[model samples]
Target: MLRQDLAAIVRAGFSAAAAGRLLERALAPGDALPDGALRVIAAGKASSSMAEAARGLLGSRIRGGLVVSPEPRSVPSPFEAIAGGHPMPTTGSEQAGRRALALAASLQADETLVVLLSGGASALMAVPAAGVALDDKRATTDRLLRAGADIHALNTVRKHLSAIKGGWLAASAPCACRAFAISDVVGDDLSVIASGPTVADSSTFSEAADVLRRFGEEAAYPGAVVARLAKGARGDVPETPKPGDPRLVRAASAVIGGRRDAMDGAAREAGTLGYHVVWIDDPVVGEARIAALLHLRGVVARADGVARPTCIVSSGETTVRVIGDGKGGRNQEFALALAAPLASLGGAAAAASAGTDGIDGPTDAAGAVVDQTTVERARAAGLSPDTFLDHNNAYAFYNNAYAFFAALGDLILTGPTDTNVGDLQIILLA
Candidate 1:
């Protein structure tokens, strides 16, 4: 029953129909460029699907462009494959970044640029700012991830340090541009997803400097990098295309997919299963353990006096502050923390959690599902959830208990889901 419920939640969010509809809304037929007017250039996890949808809408009128994503074994017409890194920047990311830049620069003055963007675009479409080497950007990105910085903060620093981010791509285009964004950030900050290749950024260099001071590597930034940011802050380097920038007057953007969509899907499925569903807002942030506690509190509040089964559905990215020398991702840490808490609550209700993408952190498992039995089981094995969490080993804790859940048990793994809209978490109170 527990597995069935969790599976239903996963299926609800990832359907061919919903994905297609989102693509249609993101690239409405009328929004397509006029005959021989559009040049498509895109990158991200969902770029493939988004590109396919664009080609479908535009047909022979579409001008071909490059797309960077995890390798799609099955080729779709009109989408070229350029595999790149995710969650971590790599050398391949650098190559794709350059290609994206060259493509954007190639747009004719009379043409329209249609860019397909989503999460992972930052790394998959990396183009370092003037003085920063690709390696430097990679180092900084890795540091930010390890530091547990949220997407917005991490992207702020990334935009300042990259030539392609912070609306630089749009500004560089020789023609009007429109970006179709699948927002993974909580608030759908256009500038954060892939560092806002098509949208303007409001964060200043000083702000980026402050983020570095707070959680970034100030000394690690290349000397030239530091000077460029300082210059940009002083209005010399050109602020990322702003609202009224002539270039953006004809440019537009829309978020076609996000945590909200994921939650809505889960809620509908849960409702059909005779479970009361409660969906929190999409942008929930903060430390993973604390977030887990908050989620548990909500469930407790509803379950205390209710007789009908309840399922708490949430979709958002959370941060995990890595302190110990352990291995796990934010989702794993969240599940481990929640497991102990739910067990302590001592109810008949079971719990399940997962990353919709089927992979969390460095581990292969998406996340975990626990019930009152998890804590007691772990304790009997002389393994404390708290101890594993302290060591940043949530994967270890949950895997040993036979509770970790990944899509199709990771055998049918889609690797990186090409598109990221944070995470989908469904906590069953039945």
Candidate 2:
């Protein structure tokens, strides 16, 4: 019963519908565009939902626009939605990027541009900078990701190498521009969300270069990618717009939802279920497995004076360094890391970690659930959690190889919440 309840609570907080409702309210008409029509561009995993919200509020006032999404679909008659690559950019992504830039450039001085952004947009709307090949950019992106670069660091490199990121999109338009976002990063920094296409960037090419160097990936990146950063850092190429740039004076941005919303939603649902809630606000970061160990220690310590039926909630994004050839995301790795430790503790508890977007890595399942008996079950089923974990094969541990989690009905499979606010974890103790 607690396992089912745990999944339900996580769902209540990470609901795409709830996130969509927030977007609809944020898109409410503030004022009419005097003397001109309005144009819009929505990007990221939440692209279609955001575009739909804007259409409901603005109607014919919107002239036409593009929605760069991770999936293909039809929005309204005037708006076109194209499936772009995620975690990597594809030809469709390039088309979206160019179309987005052209759309922004078409805005007249009296007209306005409304940019809707969310997670995955950085890759979906990627337009390589001058002389930078899309293939090279893709290779660099893959390298940084596998090297475990955080969102801030990853976006820093992306901003400098992109034609439409790091305030470049906003700078290209002379008309007044406003951006609304659903953040999937820590602190909800507007400039980091979707690499801040419509928000001014303070990060520099130098920082981007440093990120590559820090990860020991500088030399391995494509020569053009390397040369572009070198040129941008050396001022041979123009840098992305910085803070207080005149070109960005016409643009404004806001973050409407993020990890905090996921946490708050979980807390509310846990309370309604008659559990005393304990929230750990410190963000979970760093290596996925290590973060899980740290999180487990914190939860166990909190159980000291707490009442029974306690729900411990926290949400943050983490990175997974792909050392082993395996299939799983950070959240899956995170959940797998907890199995042995919690089994050793032997308590009446159930823990679940999942992405709000209903995806973890390349897997169809959002995440997985683990209980004290998880390790025991696996051992009896001729499986080893540590072996699966060491190979970064958490998905196999949960689904494919033995399908232990599937057998227990603990694998979380909520398809495409279409909202990105990082990941949520719930530990219910009774």
Candidate 3:
């Protein structure tokens, strides 16, 4: 019997949301000096929500501000909200970028600047550098994403080509900037948060060029972008401000949430469900399939060693090298791969993988869950897990079992959750 506990599923789905709430709780009015004259500026996937949180803390004292974020513009925030394109820069994103830069440039020395940053900020809050067009930036971003470039590499190139990223916004603002960030990348490197608009950058132009060349995407990127890097590498264009630079002297940054937060909550919930909890690690980044394979091997080993009910918990962003035109994200891909390996073990325990953010890759569902019987069920339905895994079509495979696997409510969902820490995977070896 494939017993589905709707409440448990909902609990798992809401765990990430609970983590997001915890992040917002860490922000206090005392964190930022209540000078009644701070100019708020934020950008990223969660920038809007973070801005809203700050606004609630600041109340009517805010001296006006601007936020650049993905569109289908969020509800009227206390401050001005400007929606922009994401994963790729568009004309609207360019306009929002200008507005953000203008807002930063207008800040006075006496005015404190509050910056809210999160993932997706790089593409959403894009401001093209000199001689770079929006179309060119979009094309370059598309190429990098398709080539399976990791987040760090993609953002490195993005920062160098942007007018606002790589600490330009901080440099533009004369006011002392205080950054409140939601970290999405592993290690929580500030430079990776929305490409580090308010924080100092350590990446060099030559490194940016190297990433493109290594990915075989050098030719796909704009010639102008490449030329600019070459010039910057030769010292014509100034490097980004490093740590301890005078510009960063008055700046402040804090990470309120991350992958571990989600993972911890999920582990707790699994324990409550009568499973022996096993916490792996949070923010486990790398190739999705390999991670899945390793996880399966561990689960199989553990299952063989004990008769006690057990569950394994892990969190991290995984990458999928798109070899074909397929529809799926890392979490989905991971789940599909796990199903293949778990099929060899055979049993009734269920394993579910999900993105803490709810939306995994371009798919609507957060991820998928499969039991030992799922493979035979899939085979009976004429669905070949191995065949689809090769094509990166996990979404399609799960869609066929939507009644079961896809019913898992997403932790990442609509409405601003005010956070982005990455994915969380849980395997209940009952």
Using lDDT as the measure, the top candidate is: 2
Q: Report the lDDT tens digits of candidate 3 across residue range 1-430.
A: 2235323642464455443264467665365463648887777666666666766666676878877777655634457877877667778788878888888789878888887777677877778888788887888888888778888999898888888888888878877888767777888788887788888899999999898898885667789888888888899887877787897777777776776767666767766777777767535577888888877776566556554577677777888888866875787788777776666665556666765555677776666666667777778878888777788877777776556544543122333444567766777665
- What lDDT tens digits, residue by residue, belong to model 1 across residues 269-294? 88888987766663556888888888
lDDT of each: 0.72, 0.86, 0.72
lDDT of 2 by residue, 350-386 (tens): 8999999899988888888988888888888788888
Q: How many Å off is the CA of 410 in candidate 1?
A: 12
Model 3, clash count?
A: 4
* Error in Å for residue 261 of model 3: 1.0
Backbone clash total, candidate 2 = 0
TM-score of each: 0.91, 0.96, 0.90
How does residue 423 of candidate 3 score in lDDT? 68
Point out the worst 10-residue segment of candidate 2 by lDDT: 27-36
Q: Candidate 2 at 206: error in angstroms?
A: 1.3
